[model samples]
Target: MAEMIVLKGLIKRFGDLLAVDDISLDVKRGEVLGFLGPNGAGKSTTMKMIAGFLTPTAGTATVCGHEVTEQPVEVKKRIGYLPEGAPTYGDMTPATFLDFIAEIRGFTGTERTKRVDAVVETVDIKEVLCQRIETLSKGFKRRVGLAQSMLHDPEVLILDEPTDGLDPNQKHHVRNLIRDMAANKAIIISTHILEEVEAVCSRAVVIGHGRLLADGTAEDLMARLPYHNAVAVRVTQDNLSIVQEGLSALGPVEAVAEAGGLTRLRVAADDGKARLADVAGLIQDKGLAVREVFVERGRMDDAFRDITKGETMESLHQGDGNA
Candidate 1:
């Protein structure tokens, strides 16, 4: 539960533009922090400052107790960074590229060979080990980049779009690898993919205009959506009104929409909290033959859209957690 990475009022400005407006956050060991934002939202910029790739315009960033600006080399030695696009030396084969990384990380002789072999196997890039990085497919290239970042087995990991070029299976593979490694490391993953937040991250941070908009667990963010835990009842066309009116009587109905010849009803909670069981009784009492009934837990994309549109966290139903 130790804090591995901490940002205190971090700020990054590019000439006239304040790319990363004063923002602060923390990533603790044994936690996977999903860093999310829209394009040009300063996600990559902030991460760069933390990784020592760019100097911050203001504020401070620390990795494992070492200040990024003051002890950049020490910070670099304790963390693994995979930048956006997973850039690598295209001319070198995976074997050579990883070996070079191992050496740079201070591995030597047998230790260097062991680390390279372990990473190559871990990323499952043996098939392309001897292939030039440019000759390898995008997915393979990304795997190579991942291998290099993990070669040193650092305590903190800063991955910017780690699964950018991967397909569904490949993405799943990488996600599983991250989960396996999460117990002992503090990981910061900057990505546009929402599912990755749900899949691997223990907590998510949403930023916009370089300011911290929302910070909490995935469920906390989802609870901001109006449809959080809303139930959907699909009844026959003839019974649409009956179902709608019956459900509305039970609680406030948000909307009733038709799709695929079935009516989907969204019931709302008056106190900004969803009550699922109340709707179930209405369906039974009405004796309406329902084709389908589903409970929506919540959707991250919906919350993201709302947050980025200048909707403050305070505006969301505050009973649900918000930061």
Candidate 2:
């Protein structure tokens, strides 16, 4: 896949505060990059520069090989941007708003109508098409914002909190649309939502204090958790003590509460590697009758917090796959 979005040494400053500091990243076609950071972490600042809405204090932003500063109009033509809050003309109805956007994108006559209709259906905003944007529910307003972003079918999409106000169904629909579009476009979505990244993003980037802190696939990030590939064993209460004692030789054992006449024990890998087979073999040798065993994928929520809150990535490596 071609690299469609690139930022090098990107910096943003307001008065004495540096909003984005020496950040850099690239998004390739067929990839959805989750741009994540805590509140006031400069995620949106970096995005605004990439989308040509804010000029960088230093460094360069590029889209489709066009430098954002040198070729703002060309860059805009190739990107679809959904800003924070999904701002729109509150007085305009969805129908008029989409049509107006289509016209602005150079569509005409039947082509314009098709674009408008396609996005309305894509976002499932048909029912609210005739209502004013401000008058619609928050979810409906968000859908309208989404419809406008994709109205021109731009090759790159920069969505800030794409599912911000969406309900479950709307979020699912938008995420599915993002996945479907990933094969053809390079997408950068700024969101603090962890599951959203896991669901649609092929790569995840973490920023904190206005600096690029981590970047990798979601699995890579998760692998840094203490129990990334840890083993889980479920057995009858009778075997619980034996299993716990035996597993302790391999790594720390955390026992979960008993349920349904069974006790669950989780064993973290000492070497930060998947050791399920090693554990299973131990059970086999001991003639232990275990109910079930599985490898854990680790906790994403913990990983996200560790990655974004910490000052340095090296100190937070619970495993080797640090971004």
TM-score of each: 0.95, 0.89
Ten consecutive residues with minimal summed lDDT in candidate 1? 314-323
Over 246-286, each residue of candidate 1 has an lDDT whose tens digit, in order, gives: 87786666555576777677876545566667777767776
Expressed as tens digits, the lDDT of each residue in 197-310 for candidate 2 is 999999988888897777888887887777788899998888888888887777688998676888888888757777888898888887777889999888778887777768
Best by TM-score: 1
Deviating ranges (above 4 Å) for candidate 2 = 234-240, 249-251, 255-264, 270-272, 281-292, 316-323
| CA displacement after TM-score superposition, residue 21 of candidate 1 (Å) | 0.7
What C-alpha RMSD separates each model from the true structure?
1.9, 2.9
The TM-score, computed over Cα atoms with residue i paired to residue i, of candidate 2 is 0.89
What value does the lDDT take at residue 20 in candidate 2? 96
How does candidate 1 fare on TM-score?
A: 0.95
